[model samples]
Target chain A: MTRWGMVIDLGRCIGCQACTVACKVENQSPVDAWYAPVVEYEVGRYPDAQMAYLPMLCNHCTDAPCIKACPSGALHRRDDGIVIADEEICIGARACMTACPYGALHLHEGRSGELLGDGTRNTPSILERYAHERHIEGTVSKCTYCAHRIDFGTEHGLTPGIDPEATPACVVTCPTECRVFGDLDDPDSPVSRYVVEHGPTGVLRPDARTGATTAYVGLP
Target chain B: MSAPVSALPQNVFMDRWALEPKTQRVWGVNHAGWFTLMGIGGGVFLLGRIFDITLEAGRVLGLPIVDVVSFVTIAIGGLILIADLGRPLQAWRAFRNVRVSIISWGAWADLVFLTFGGLLMLPDLTFGDSTPFSGLGWDSHATSGIGRVMLVLASIAAVVVMVYAGAVLARPRSIPYWHSVAIPIQFLASSLAMAMATLMLIVVLDGGDVTRSELLATAGLTAVLLVTIVVHLSTRTTAPGKKESIERLTRGSLRGTFLYAAVGAGTVLPIVLGLLALGFDGGAREVLAVLTLPLLVVGGFLLRLDTLRAGIYPPVVSLLEAAQR
Candidate 1:
């Protein structure tokens, strides 16, 4: 009966992209596909211009449009409220890609095996990377709320939001402590408490009726 | 709407605040080809069956030419669909979840149409129900009951194949321009028109007679397609990317493809030519039919192509507007 979610405090976000790098390092997503990139935009005219950052990731809605759009039943939700795309069943129709209001899902086309541009040799070769459930070719992927870590943590008697070993890499790596992660169903959880404290926390594409788990404070 | 600072390919994420629409890169020429072929195949099958069911005038002694065309196009379209997939080998997995997924519905529809459609054509063929049957069984090929039922099943599947191609696109709310009930109906109209035109050409080439109702069906479907185009053009909804979609089709980058090719040449020209051909008979009428049918058929393909290319996703910023709402 758990619903994992996150609440982002935009007021506290410094736009340093620490969480972005953390997500990339942890997830090792395909090339040009950032699972948790903080997209920055400028506000106001030149005289009062300032950068505003929006950290983008899968909202993991209760009524996920991607899951509904998928013809192959590749995308599914776990009992603990995590959305996952199973590589074995995925036919790569890309319908979920179009159905998603927020461009959270990414198509992995075996870019992990290829060498990076400019001969940087930054990332490890595909063979050297973690083989199990890492990157699957010709399948859609998105943020899984680090369910692997959560399951591991739960088995070992650790709290998700409080324990760095259990939480998502992005939440753990944020220097400003802008990202809060916990079970949304539990009122005592950090995420629920944060949302309760900050009344009217905003969600992206509320009109989509996605019942978005990710909420934001100081949206402007 | 805030103005963009850089002129990127619209789809690329940039430092823009405004909710500009970006063209979807998911479906391309391959998908367009798939949609076009499926529509044509389904249309031809449905039109031919209408004659069989309603007027009881469908060919029984020989393989119905229209059904063959339908089978071929659907086969080709199915291949194209597989080719268009990221994982082509696993394309069979797409047939699951027909209840919830429109794509699955389409896959099942195509499969059913192919299976039952091919089977239904067998008993009607001169050699189909004989040699192999006589050798295997005592040549009593009188399975009295299922002809009409099979025909109805195949016909329904054919209709789904034609309509679901549009429903697949229409089901996506990410693009407001395509998220309309009008799209499937328009596709249905366009598919039948294209099929009718193709049938007309076949009749002309084979020296078979052209029926008046066929021409009337063609004209009626074409008229419906024309009205749908007008509806598409006049859709100035405030649904994020709708304005940009309209602009793209009307006066923007996609204008040449949408306006000139899909509309002017494919749609309007055929109507004008068909109207003029009504004034003639004999060889003149035949020549006019030949010219007009090709346009209608080609127009059908272009309509699918241009529409697929015109699918613009409201820029990433559009989410903020929805968030605000």
Candidate 2:
């Protein structure tokens, strides 16, 4: 019954990519593939220019289209409400990724197809990264909401099995505290309370009707 | 929806239509090419079993070595499939979204089953003696439980392989002509159709006597093709302007293939051959069925080839023009 949600305060946001780097390193995702990306856009005429950055990731829709489209049953929503994928069961089908309107997923490559030898095609320094782990050329991956860490959060003394003390890497790394996470079902939770405080002017891409659990508050 | 000059404009010929000799020749060759490759895989498996046959007891046909054959055949089939795709590197992009795309899901389904099938066939491939003769890959000892577990998993994947090919191509949204849910049914129908046809053709060409089972297979395949056509016609849906587009094939360029190969030789002729044997004894009827199997197989291939060729992408340009109007 507990649906987790996030409240992102755009007013206090800065476009610094610390959150992106944190997510990448924490997830150990390849440099080319980003679990979270900040999309930059410019608005208004040149005389009165303004720039904005929107950090995009899985919206984790209630009626997730990705789940319904997966033929292999690799992607499934867990009892705790997190959508997870069984990599072994996945057939490298990209249907779920395309079904996502928000462009949330990416295919995870397997170790089977990685290049064997150090290359002179790129600088020796650039070759070091490739020497680390052999890339597997055919699997899909995305944010798991740091579920492993969150599940063990109580050991860090924030809360016992209820709310994990270690926030999502992106949220934890945000200097501005722009991203807030908590249970939407709990009226006392910070995210739920923030949404109740802010009005309709707050949400992003509401028309997509994903019933996005994450919210963008106080955006002009 | 003005008629295009490329098409004949009607279903005038009915059952008289046959596959263009060009396509007929090409299809036969194409199918044979694929079958030959599968035979190589099957041959490897048979070799594995023969090595074990002297050591084991009863049946010649049900030897677990068949798993090796099944694995090689499926892998060869997989290769043919990848080669057929217009883009292979971009093929990985198919997995970009599993939730909404049928092709992506189909790709996944095919891979899982294919991998499982390969794993089941592996002990033979490796020629490892740690296992024993049983079911394809099943009779082996469990020196390592992982292989046994994989065999179970592979069996499930084998079924998926059969089902996915049909389901994926039969996608409702992506390919307009392939829209019917009956497509997978058609696909299964066609695999049998082709299998029997090829078997009969090889027997005939090689001047070998045919078996009763092969004849029955032909007859059964003909019935399947007939049922598939009915199912296809009944289950199909068309967009508002698509009727005109579909008309290109129904009455135009594609009409010949659909009418002759798919309907006549593929469906009707095979049915007639089956019926002609109704009054005859098993030997004669069986002979007739074997003779007709190749034609039914041709029809099944036409269904896939013609449908693939005839399917149109949205007449986006025309639609855009109309919208502007």
Candidate 3:
């Protein structure tokens, strides 16, 4: 079975936030929402002051708390260890929001469109074509690891990590190539090879025991 | 041990993905209020059953007042909860995932309680001794049997409702302050205390004598509330996230609420009043009981609010920084 995972190399990340923009455009998330947000923080001080950027997203854990907390089973883990939310089934209870330690899940309140004054836009943007059917007011949403692309890629006999078209928007758009997407189960996969070479990859909130799939290299 | 380094400073060595510490506002006053109201409703029903079993004081104003309170509050609470939902229309989905979701179980429990509690009160509200469905051979004796069954079922459901509120919060691994065994116990104690106070108020208002035993029980439960709070605060966990949450509660921004509302007003004041009621007699005792009841109610609500507010997300930067240091 394929356990989809990601490896983000912090040393290679330039804090450019191009990945964030790509993810937002790909997901067509609300103006306020960013599926992958590059959180920038200052490190060091005085003349040695430097800025660090950390792009945050859903970890898609094996034992996801959001799945357990969802009263309606709106959030569930796929066979391949990808955690996805069924927007239609979500009752907006926000239990998953509290359950997620990563602060990845978000609720849509039907905010005004970026270009329009009445919380809407005259033209249907590119994201509208691939928008989830239940993407309406008062539903919880989160990153799906671009499941549509992955599924389509698999059907077309293309590799997810190696094929540019099959990969996640963030990974494809990352100028510094800091983001890597692949199957953790496959030892020869880029993510696995990267982990083996760089060694001692870090998962966020390991103590949370959610069995996070997203690993980090050169985190600190 | 090396001096504990604070994670608040901007220039800190931490994980690249470390997020700034922020309290989640996913569940606000609506969630807290629903839990508070439901806890009281369920607690009242459970206490009423104890009263029926022991004191045979089930009827108030020629009706089961506790049953009435349960019916009203649970119904209102259920509605409030539904209204709080993003898709209120799809709330029926909450009933599907019963095995894993406490929310599903809670919905089912509330429905059961409401059904039985409503049936129990129907006889009094309707034709009294004369059976409304005599043609169906449903007599007063049969109705009494149904009421008895309702009483048992409602009581069980009531207990579930009380525990469910805390259990839902406890299930989340993120907020360590909430994910504790002590949270449910504290909620249970607070629920019972609030119920007893409400019952005392009702009895006093109805010109009934406030029993010394009831006052003592309230006091005991108040003590339980205090002890549970202390235990919840003091219990050590290996999770540093939990430790940071504890700090936020005891000495951080939420300290005023914890000190004044939850501990002082919610626990201590009620205990003092219960004690005074136990010592005093006649109208003075009744007055004290009345005063104690609202204090407990407000305190209970504040306690829920305090718990909600004190819940701090595990500081990603802090944990990573500590590991590096």
The sequence of per-residue lDDT tens digits that candidate 1 reaches over residues B15-117 is: 2332446677677788878888888898887876564421233343455676778888999999999887878899988888776888998899988989878
**For residues B1-325, could you state the per-residue lDDT of candidate 3 as single tens digits?**
2212221111121223456565666676777788888988998877866654212344543456666776788788899999999899999999877878889999999999887766665555445566453353222122456556666787788899988989998987788788888888888899899988888877776668788888998899989999989887888754666676777767887777777777898899989989988889999999998888878888888888878876767765453563442
Q: Identify the runs in model 1 with alpha carbons over 4 angstroms from their true place.
A: A112-134, B1-20, B52-62, B124-144, B318-325
Per-residue lDDT tens digits for candidate 2, residues B124-241, read 4333444333335343332356666764565455445544544544443323444456666666555555545444444444445455454555567558757876655544335422
Clashing residue pairs, candidate 1? none
**CAPRI-style class, candidate 1:** acceptable
| Model 3 CA deviation exceeding 4 Å by range | A45-48, A113-134, B1-18, B53-62, B127-149, B237-248, B319-325
**Pick by lDDT: which candidate is best?**
3
lDDT of 3 by residue, A1-220 (tens): 8999999988888988898888877787754456787777766565776777677789999989998888998888899888998878999888888888887887775543333433334554545433523366688788889988899899999999999888999999999899989999999998888888886788777767898998788766
The TM-score measured for candidate 2 stands at: 0.46
Model 2 has how many clashing residue pairs? 29
lDDT, model 1, position A128: 31
By DockQ: ranked, best first: 1, 3, 2
Poorest stretch of ten by lDDT in candidate 2 chain B: B13-22
Q: Which ranges in model 2 have alpha carbons more than 4 Å from their true place? A: A7-19, A38-55, A59-79, A85-103, A110-138, A159-165, A172-180, A194-220, B1-72, B75-161, B168-183, B206-325
C-alpha TM-score for every candidate: 0.89, 0.46, 0.88
Among all candidates shown, the one with the greatest DockQ? 1
Q: After best superposition, candidate 2 residue A125: deviation in angstroms?
A: 6.7
- Our tally of clashes for model 3 stands at 2
